[model samples]
Target: MMPLNNSMLITGGAGFIGSYLINQLIVKGVNVICLDNFDEFYPRKSKENNIKSFIASPLFTLIEGDIRNKELLDDIFKKQTIGIVIHLAAKAGVRPSIINPQEYFDVNVNGTLNLLEVMKNHSVQNFIFASSSSIYGNNLKIPYSELDNVDFPISPYACSKKSGELLTHTYHTLYNMNVINLRFFTVYGPGQRPDLAIHKFVNNIYKNIPIEVYGDGSTSRDYTYIDDTVTGILAAIHYLEINTNVYETINLGNNYPVKLSDLIEIIEEITQKKFIEKKLPIQMGDVNITFADITKAKQLLNYHPKVSLKEGVINFKKWYEKKLV
Candidate 1:
């Protein structure tokens, strides 16, 4: 890989995926500037702990701010020579978005616009967006592809992500920016967000609490390990580095869909605990499935997911146990 000429700015850099991506970039001798507002969706300490190790590194710089603030974004661009912008900051979760649609649009859509405007003004052309598979909605397609028509989004969060993808493409076409929109599948592993199913289930089972199983446990997700997702992201960054006039939307996923019941069983076996399963009706905004077609990722970026669901769950278990100590 060619050496980066300037620092990479990752919005939401203190979050789960952002923190992991920053660690990898810094290890490769690349400078990183992480911007995060540390939203109240989860505990602030967890996000803080995510990037605690990187605080002292000369290659890492954390900016506590919101993406909606165009002034702050402009000031950041003016001060730092940023080579690439990985926009990962957004109002996440489908259910939460349904409860607060306006906030989702304001942050995910307008905030993205703010960043793009700043980047355009500063002439920073390289960009990568963290999109979501939920944009597929409840499409009948077994494996969601980039070519699939995603005109119908079921939830506000999904709509927000679809909006982000469109915004990136618009910027790419008008500004001649090199961009990639990566639709991430269900990502889980060590340092995973506490709100996610895997993390929540693991903790609940470990404590012998009843775990909620929405919709019959038949609903499935293409659970991609965090390492695999980050690998695909880095590959996308490299592709942007070596190519030009590029605008591609690709899926970074495990490609293997695991039903909710199977996921719980794996966690149960791994943690050596019995789970009290509380069945609940499928909540609104929750999709029936999320399976990714990574053929484009494989061909374009040579990306392949290496971690299996069981293995990833084991890794998370180890990390959670260590954290408890």
Candidate 2:
């Protein structure tokens, strides 16, 4: 069983999911040390605002550093009494990864390696990795399972994540580290990163901007909400407390896929506005669909997602009006 401590290190703790995770941990009175470099994937200010609400908390520490920085991670490990590591830092977005494969590999793969090396040195064995459903690639299987073959990744981002999982597995095999890689589906909600489809569509429609419709708007994704994903992360940590001698991957998703066109319609209905649609060719690396088989999550962690797309879109629009407006 993994050791219990008050402190936990969460990389990329300033991003959308990290912010929510930090907040929840803070409420539970866990000492959370957030490490983020504030990469320009989006504006630094938005990411700063994500954790600004809880930045001043006594139990929270925000470290501005890159995952690629071994010295910085070493310093944090040496100084702080962190019991577990939640690795969430990555160069996100499949389209951007295509344009800059080197940067993606460097940050996603090399950075994860650097962190794992540091963790090995410190003997911090309990770990929770934030993986992506994009690793499933264009598989013919519906409702991709943890047992599915993920050898064929179309984008550098997916490849990077898959590499991270493999690295984690090796560590588990050699060091007996406890690890759980969570394959998060298309996560969307209030304060979501602007690059995601649901947020972009809602914002563009509100501003009367033309929305990009890729693949004739038939592409579908299993959109998991922020709360459900965070709950699963906490459960993984809890599971690690009692279980060890294991390396496992589970899908933390809603298990319900929504089409791009139907998502647009929901946004329009929520905002009471129509958007101009601009059709684009099916992107080369884009997958046909992403449907998660969350059966393992339900059985292992008792994970049950409670949000629907319509309700989630409404919630997103409400937060968008207040924050983005």
Candidate 3:
């Protein structure tokens, strides 16, 4: 990989995927500016600890702010000379989005617009938007494709993501900015967020708490490990180095869907502990399944995921034991 000439700004840089990506950049000695508000979606301490590994590095600059703050974004753009922007900040979670639709839109949709405007002003065209598979919603499609109709988002979070993707498209159309909307599958692994199933299940199982199962354990997710997802993102970032003035949306996933029940069993096998299953009703915004079709990612970005669910679960379990337990 060629050396980066200017700093890279990663929105929500302290969060799961962001933190991991930052560590990778740090190892490469790439100058990085991490912007995160430490949203209360989870404890701020968790996010703080995620960056503890490289926060003190001279290559990294941490900004404590929100993406909605356009003035702050502009100020950073004026100072940092950022060559690329990886927008990952958002009010995540589909179920919570059902209760507070406005917050989701405010942070995810409007906040994204703020960042785009700032980048437009700065003339920093390279952008990689961290989109979600939830945008697929309850589409009858088995393996969701980037070309599939993402117009039917069931939850506010999904809707906000779809809106962000559309807004990115519009910015690309008008400004001729380079944009790649990566529709990430269920990303899991070390430093996984607390609310995610892999994180929660491992914690609850370890503490002998009841592990909740929604939708009769039939609903499945295309779980892409954090390492794999971050690789695709880095590829997308480097892609702008060779490809320019284009708008593209690609799916980055394991291209494998594992049943909810099977996921729990995998966890049990890894931990050598049985879970007290508490079957719950299906979530309102939850989709029946999320299976990614990564053909476009492979063709364009040469994105290929290496981690399997079992291997990813074991890696996460090792992390859980070392960090939380």
**Against the true structure, whose lDDT is highest?**
1
For model 2, residues 23-68, the per-residue Cα lDDT tens digits are: 9999988999999999999999989889999999999999999998
Please rank every candidate by lDDT, starting with the best.
1, 3, 2
RMSD of 3: 1.5
Candidate RMSDs in order: 1.2, 0.9, 1.5
Model 3's TM-score against the true structure: 0.98
| Of 1 and 3, the candidate ranking higher by lDDT | 1
Which lDDT tens digits does candidate 3 get at residues 1-325?
A: 2126989999999999999999999898899999999999999999989999998999999999999999999999998888889999999999999999999999999999999999999898888899999999998977898889888989999999999998999999998888989999989998898899999999999899997789789999999999999999988988887776768899998999999999988988989999999888997999999999999999998888999999999998888888864
- Local error of candidate 2 at residue 31 (angstroms): 0.4
* Alpha-carbon lDDT, every model: 0.93, 0.91, 0.92
Q: Candidate 2 has what TM-score?
A: 0.98
The TM-scores, one per candidate, come to: 0.98, 0.98, 0.98
Over 1-325, each residue of candidate 1 has an lDDT whose tens digit, in order, gives 2237899999999999999999999999999999999999999999999999888999988899999998899999999999999999988889999999999999999999999999999999999999999999999977999999999899999999999999999999999988899999988999998889999998888788898889999999999999999999999999988887899999998899999989988888898889998999999999999999999999999998999999899899999999999
Cα misplacement distance, residue 314 of candidate 2 (Å): 0.8
